[model samples]
Target chain A: MPDLPIILAGVINGLLAGGIYVLVAVGLTLIYGVLHIINFAHGSLLMLAMYAVFFLFKPPVGIDPYLALPIVTGGAFIFGYLVYRWLIGRFNHGRDENILLITLGLSIVIDNAALMFFTGDIQTIDVPYAGRMVELGAAFLPVPKIISFFAALLLCGALGLYMARSDTGKAIRALAKERQGARLVGIDVDKLFAVSYGIGIACLGAAACLLMPTFYVSPTSGHAFVLIAFTTVVLGGMGSFAGAAVGGFIIGITESLGGLLLGEQLGQIGISLIFILILLLRPSGLFGGKG
Target chain B: MSRGTLALCAAGLLAAILYPLVVRGLAGAGVGVSANYLINVGMLVFFVAFIGQSWNIAGGFAGQTSFGHVVFFGTGAYCSTILHVTHGWNPWLAWPVATAAGALVGWAIGALAFRAGLKGSYFALITLAFAEVFRILANSVEFTRGGLGMLIKADQRPENFQFRDPMWIYYLALALCVVSLAIAWQLTRGRFGARLVAIRENEDAARALGIDVYTEKVKVLALSGAMCAAGGTFYAQKYLYIDPSIAFGVDKSVEMLLVSMVGGAGTVFGPLVGSLVLTAINEGTRSLASVVPALKNVQPLSLIVYGAMLILIVARLPDGLMGLFGRRKSGKRHDA
Candidate 1:
C-alpha cells in the first residue's frame, strides 16, 4: 500500500480541483438567484474566455495567461453586460423553458463557432509552471493548481466582500430577495439584474483565466466542466454562494478519491453515482434549500 | 376529426410515400443526377422527424423537457447491435427486443425522476446527468469497444437486414416516420391527450382536477422513449454501425429539442415541420457551399443558424411555426 502522505496529497489535489468548481458553481448560483434563469451556456461562455486567454498568450498580444486576467475578465464582464441588455432582456417575461432552450441554442452556436474558427484542434497555453511542482513533506502540488487554488479563494473572498458591502451588490441581493419591495424603494431592478449577470460571468472569467494554464481549451472540453458545474451547484444547494464553494470542495474530493480507488474510467462512474444519490437523498441539495 | 386535420394528414401521408418514388423516378430518368442525395436527405428528415415526434410526446404534451433523450436512442442502438452482432440474431429480429430494453430504461428513469419529485429544470438536468453517466460507461466498457466504434458487415443479405440499395432503408425510415406520426396524432387528439396538455399547462391544477399527473407523465415518457428507441434501431440498421457518440451524444438530444421546438412544442405537425426546416437549412447551406468556395469551410454555419433559430423561437415565437397561423395560443406559460 502507498504511504498515508500520498493519500493526503490526493485529497489535497482533489480539493484543488474543487476550487475551480467553486468558482463555476458560485457564478451559476449567483445568476440563478437573481435572474431566475439557469444560464446553460455558462460553461460555453467560460470556454470563450479560455480561448481569449489562449490567443492573448500568443503573438503581438503576448502576455501571460495570469497577466491577461484583468483584460479577459473585464472583457467578459462587458460581453455579459451586452448579453443581458440585448439577448436575455428579450425573454424577461418568457417561460422558464425559454431560457433553457435559448441557452441550449447559445451553447450549440458557441461550440460550433469555436469548432469552425479554431478547427476542433486543442489549444494549450503553456506556462513555465507546467512542469513545476512544490514538494511538501511526502506530498507534491503542481504549481498551476496552486496558483488556481489561491486565485479562486481570493476571488471568492472578493465576491463575498462585494456582496456584503458594495451598493450594486446589495441592490442585486435586494432584488433577488424581494423584487417588489426593492422596486418600491426605487431600485433599478433591470439594471441591477444585468449587473448581477455580468458579475456572474466575470466570476466565470476569472476561473477560465486560472484554468488555461493547466487545461487544454477546446470547443468540447467545456462539456465536462459543465456537468461538473451542474453537479457542484446542485450539491451545494442552488443559489447559495457559500454552499457553492463548499459543494465544490466536496465534489472535488469525492471525484479525486474516487479516481484513485477506481482507476479513472470507473472512477467517474462511482463519482456520478454518488452525485445521483445526493440528489435522491436531498432533493433540495446538501446546503440551502432555496432555488 | 376536423376536416382540416383530416385533409392535412392525408396530404402529409401522400407526400411522404410519393416523395421518395418521385426522387427514384428522377434517378431512373437520369435527370439532375442528385436524386440519390435527395433520397438520403429525405431519409434523415424522416428519421429525425420520428425521433422528434417521440420527444414531443414527453416534452411537448407531457411538459417534461428532457435534455437526455438520446439515452433511449443509445440504448436501442446498443441493444440491437449487440444482439445482432454477438448473438447472431437477425437485425430485424433484434429491433423489437432492443425497443423493449429502451422502454424498460425509460420506465426506470421515469420511476426514479418522478418518485424523487424532480420537476422542471431539475428534471431536465438529472436526465442530462444520467445520459452523461451512461455515455462515460459506454466509452469505458470493454464490450462496448470503448470509443473504438462498432461496425456490422456490409454483406448484402436481406435476411440480415443488408440491402443492395439504400432506397430500401430510406423507405423503411419513412414508414417508421409515418407510423410514429400516426401514433402521435392518435395520442394527442384524445381526452387523455387533453389531460396531458393540462398537466403541462399547470401541474398543480392537473392534480387538483383529479388527473393522475405522475402516471400520465411516466406513461408518456415510456411511450416516447420506446418510440425514440425504434428510431435508434432503424438508425443502426440503416448505417450498420454504432459508436458511443453516435448513439448517445448530447447533439442527438438537442436535435430532437430543435425539431420539436422549431415546429411547435405542443402541436402535432410541429416536429415534422421542424424536421423539414432543419433539413432544408442544413442542405441549403451545404449546397450553397458547393457553389461558393469561401463558404465551403464554414461547415458550422448551419449550426449557428440553428442556434439563432432557437433563440428566435424562444424569444419571438414561443408557439413556433404553429403560432404563425394564430389558431391556438401559446401552450407554455409566461414567467412573472
Candidate 2:
C-alpha cells in the first residue's frame, strides 16, 4: 500500500490533468450539443493546433506558448468555422452516421497530412519555467500544470457565463434544445451552427497552448487524446457542459489512481472499462437528461 | 440477378483466376510487369477485400457502423498464434479454434451491447472502447508475451499452412474472398438478410414487424466475426508474426471501414471494388514517391488521397462507387 502522501500526490496530479481533459471534453460535448455530431477530428485538430504553437515557439518566430495562445485560438476558430461552412455543413443531412463518416474522413486527411509535412518525429519545446515546481503539502506539481489548471477553470467559467448570458449563446442553446423551433423563431440556425463549432474548436486551441509546455507534439499525438476525450465526453454525458466538467475530473482521478494501483500498461484498461460500463449501465450519464 | 450482372460477375471471376498466370507469363517474356510484385498486390487486395466484406456484413448491410471490428481480427490472430506457438498445437488445428474464439467474442459483444439497446454512434463508440480494452489486456498479459509479440516458426510445407510459393498464398486469399462473397450473396438472397436490412432501415419498425432484431443482429455479428477471424489467421500465417499493435490496431479497423464504405456498403461486390481502388491508389502513390526525389516521405500521401475520397464519397456519392453502377439498376437491390 502506498503512503497517504503518495495517494494525495496522485490525487493532485489527477486533478491537474483533469483540467486539460475538461477543456477537451467541454469542446466535444458543446459540439454534440449544438450539431448532434461527434467530431471525430477533434484530436487531430488539437494536434494541428499544437503544431501551430510549436512553429510559433521555434527559432525565427520565437514566441512563448502562453503568448501564442490568442493567435492559435483565433486561428482555430476561423479554421473551424470555415470547415463547418464548407465541408461539414454542406454534407450534414441530419444523419448521425454520415456526419461520423465525414469527420472520420477529415481526421484521416489531417493525420496523414501532418505525417507528410511534419514527419513522425516527436517535437517538444523547452521552457525556462518548465522545471519549476509548486509544492502543496505532499504534492510537487510542475508550474505549467498549475497555470494550465487555473487557466482551464477560468476559460470554462467564461464559456459558461457566455453561454448563459450572451444573445448568441442563448440562441445557440435554443438551437441545441429545439432546432426546428429555433429556426421557426427566426434565428439564423446555419450560421449559429458554424459559430458553435468554431467555439468548440477554439477550446482545443487553448488546450494545445496549455498542453505544449508539458507534452511532446507528433503526427500521431492525437491518437492518445481521441479515446481519452471520448471517454470524458461519454462519462460526462453526451451534450451536457456541467456533466463534461465533472466527468473530466472523475476520469482524471481514475487515470491517476489507476496508474498508482496498476502498472502503467494495465492502468489504461480502467478508462476503457469505465467507458463501457457507463454506456451500458447509464447511457444518459450523471448530469445528462435521458440520453 | 440480371443476365448482364451475371455475365459481368463471370468475367470478373475469370480475370481474377487468370491474373497470376498472366503476370507470370508477362515476366517470363521480359515484359514491364513484375510477377512477384503483382502477385503480392493481388493477394493483398483479396485479403483486404475479405476483411472488408466482414465489415460490410455488419456495418453496411446491417448499418451497425462499428469503429472497432479489429477486436475480432486481433482475437483470432492472437488465438491461433498462441495456440500454435505457446501450446505447441498444429497451425491447421489451431485455425478453427481461433475462428470459433472470434465468433464467441463477437457474440458476447453483440449480446451485451444489443441487450443494453445500444444503437448508432453509442454502439460504435462502445465497440471502439471494447477494442481498447482488449489491446490493453494483450499488452499487459505475460502469457501473450506482453508487448514482445509472438512469432510462428517458418516451416514452408503444404501441411503447415505456410507456403513455399507466394502464388499458393494468393490463391488461398482468393478462395477466402470467394467464400466471403458467397456468404454476402447468401445474405442478399435469404430471409435472414431481409431481416437485417429491415433492422438497418429502422430497428423499431423491424421489431414491430415481428422480426427478431436482437437475434438477427447477434447472428450477423457472429458470422462477420468468424469471417474476419479467418482472415486474421490467414494474415498471421502469411506474415508469421503477431503483435498487439498489428493484431488490434485502430488502423485495421479504419481500413476495414474505409474499404466497405468507399466501395459501396450493402452491395455484394462493394468490398472487392473498394479493395481494388484503394490498393491501386496505394501502389500508385508509392511508385510515384520512389520516382520523385523531392518527396522523401510520401507514403502518407496515399492515405491523404483516401481520406479525400472518403469525404467526397460521403458528400457526393453516398452509395459509394458501386452506387454509381447500381444507380442504373435502381430498386433492384436493397440500399440503405
Candidate 3:
C-alpha cells in the first residue's frame, strides 16, 4: 500500500486529469446532442488548436501560449462552424455512419496535414511556469497542471451557467432535446447546429491551450487524447453535458489511482478497461438521463 | 450458382493462382520487374484482403463498425508465436488454437457489449478500448518480450515456418486469401447472412420478427475474429516476428476498415479489390519516398489518403465501388 500523502497526491492528480478530460468530452457530448453524429475528428480539432497556440507563441510573436487562448478558441470556433456548414450539413439526418466516415476522413486529413507542416517531431510550449512546482507539506504538484485544472472547472461552470441562463443557450438546449419541436417553435436548426459546433470546437481549443503548457504537441498527438476523450464521453453518457463532466473526473481519478497502484503502462489500459466495464454495466453512463 | 456467378468465380480463381507465376516469368524474361517485391506485395494484399473480409462480417453486414478488430489479430499472432517459439509446436497445429482464442475473446466482448445494449459509436469505443488494453498488456508482459518484440529463431528448419523462400510464404498467404474469400461468400449468401442484414437494417424490426439478435451478433463477431486470427497466424509466420505495435496497432484496424469501405463493404469481392489497390498505393508511396529524398518526411500520407477515400466513398458511393459497376444482383433479386 502507498502512504497517505502519496494517496492524496494521486487523488489530486486524478482530479486535475479529470478536468482536462471534461474539457474534451463536453465538446464531444455537445456535438452528439445536436447533430446526432459523433464527431470522430474532434480530437484532431484539439490538435489543431494546440498547434495554433504553439505557433502563436513561437519566437517572433512571443505571446505567452496561455495568453493566446482567446485567439485559439475563436479560430477553432470559426473553423468548426465552417466545417459543420460545408461538410457535415450535407449528410442526411439519420445516416450516422456517413458522419463517422466523413469525420474519420477529416481527422486523417488534419493529422497528415499537420505531419506535412510540422513534421513528426514532437513539440511542446516551454512556458515559464510549466516547470514550476508547488510544494505542500508532503506533496508536490506541477504549477501549470494546477492552473489547467482550475481553468477547466471555471470554464465548465461558465459554460453550464451560460447554457442555463442565456437565451441562445436555451435555444440550443431546446434544439438538442427535441429538434422537431424546436423547429415548430421557429428555432433555426441549421444556425443552431453551426453555433453548437462552434461552441464545441471552442471548448476543444481552450482545452488545447490549457494542455499546451503541460503536454507535448505533435501531428498525431490528438490520437493519444482522442480515444481517452471518447471513453470519457461514452462513460458520461452519449450526449449528456453534465454526464460528460462527471465522467471525465471519474476517468481521471481512475487513471491516477491505476498509475499509483499499477505501473504507468497498465494505468492507461486500466482506465480504458474501467470505461468498458462501466459501458457494459450501464451503457447510458452514471449521470446520463434515460433515453 | 448462376452461370454468370460461376464464371466470375472461375476467372477470379484463375487470376489468383496464375498471378505469381506470370510475375515470376516476367522477371525471369528480364522484364522491368522484381519478383521478390512482387511476391512481398502480393503477400500484403492477400493478408489485407483476408482481414478486410473478416471485418466485413460484423462491420459491413451486421453494421457494428468495430474499430478494434486488430485485437483478434494480435491475440492470434501472440498465441501462435508463443506456441511455436516456446513449445516448439508446428505452425499448422498452432493455428487452430490461435483462432479458438480469438473466437473466445470476440465472443466475450460481443456478449458483454451487446448485452449492455451498446450500439454504434459507443460500441466502436468499447472495441477500441479493448484493442488498447491488449496492446498495453502485450507491451508490458515479459513473455511477449515487451518493446523489444519477438523474432523467429535463426538456423531453424524451414518446416518450423521460417522459410528462406518468399515464394513459399506467398503461396501460403494466397491460399488463406482464397479460403477467406470463400467463407465470406458463403456466409453472406446463407440464412445467417440474411439474419445479419436484417439486424443491420433494423434491430428492433429484426427482433420483432423473432430473430435472436444477441446470439446472431455474437456468432458473427466470433466468426470474424476467428478469420482475422487465421490471417494473424500466417502474418506472424511469414514475418518471422511478432510485436504488439505491428499486430495490435490501431493502424491495422483502420486499414481493415478502409479496405472494406473502399472496395464496397457488403460485396463479396470488395475486400480483394480494395486490398490490392491500397497495398499497391502503400508500396508505391514507400518506393517513391525512397527514390525521392524530399518526400522522406511524408510520414502519414497513406493514412490521409485512406481517410479521404473513406469519407468520399461513404458520402458519394454508400454502396461502395461495387455499386459503381452494378449492385449485387443476388440481394435485390432475392428481395424481389
What TM value does model 2 have?
Answer: 0.98
Predicted candidate 1 versus true structure: per-residue lDDT over A1-291, tens digit per residue: 456877787789899999999998888999998888888999899999999999999888889988888998898888888888888866766457678778888889999999888878898977887989999766688898999999999999899899989988888898989999999999998888888889888987899889999999989877878778888887877788888899899889888877787667767765567567767668667787643
The deviation in Å at residue A129 for candidate 3 is: 2.1
User: What would the per-residue lDDT of candidate 3 be over residues A1-291, giving only the tens digit for each residue?
Assistant: 899889888888889889989988999988888778889898898999999998998989887867888888888889999998988777634546668778888888898889877988899878878779998656688998899999988988898899889999999999988999999999998988999999999999899889989898998888888878887887878888888888898888888888888878766786778778878887677767774
Query: Is model 2 an incorrect, acceptable, medium or high docking prediction?
Result: medium
lDDT of 3 by residue, B60-87 (tens): 8788888899999998999998998888
Candidate 2, B35: how far from true, in Å?
A: 1.5
2 versus 3: better lDDT goes to: 2
| Candidate 3 Cα errors over 4 Å, as ranges | B155-158, B329-336
Question: Across residues B13-112, which tens digit of lDDT does each residue of candidate 2 receive?
Answer: 8998899999999999999988988999999999999999999999988889899999999999999999989999888999999899989999999999
TM-score of each: 0.96, 0.98, 0.95
Query: Model 3 — interface RMS deviation?
Result: 3.5
Ranking by TM-score: 2, 1, 3
TM-score of the candidate numbered 3? Answer: 0.95
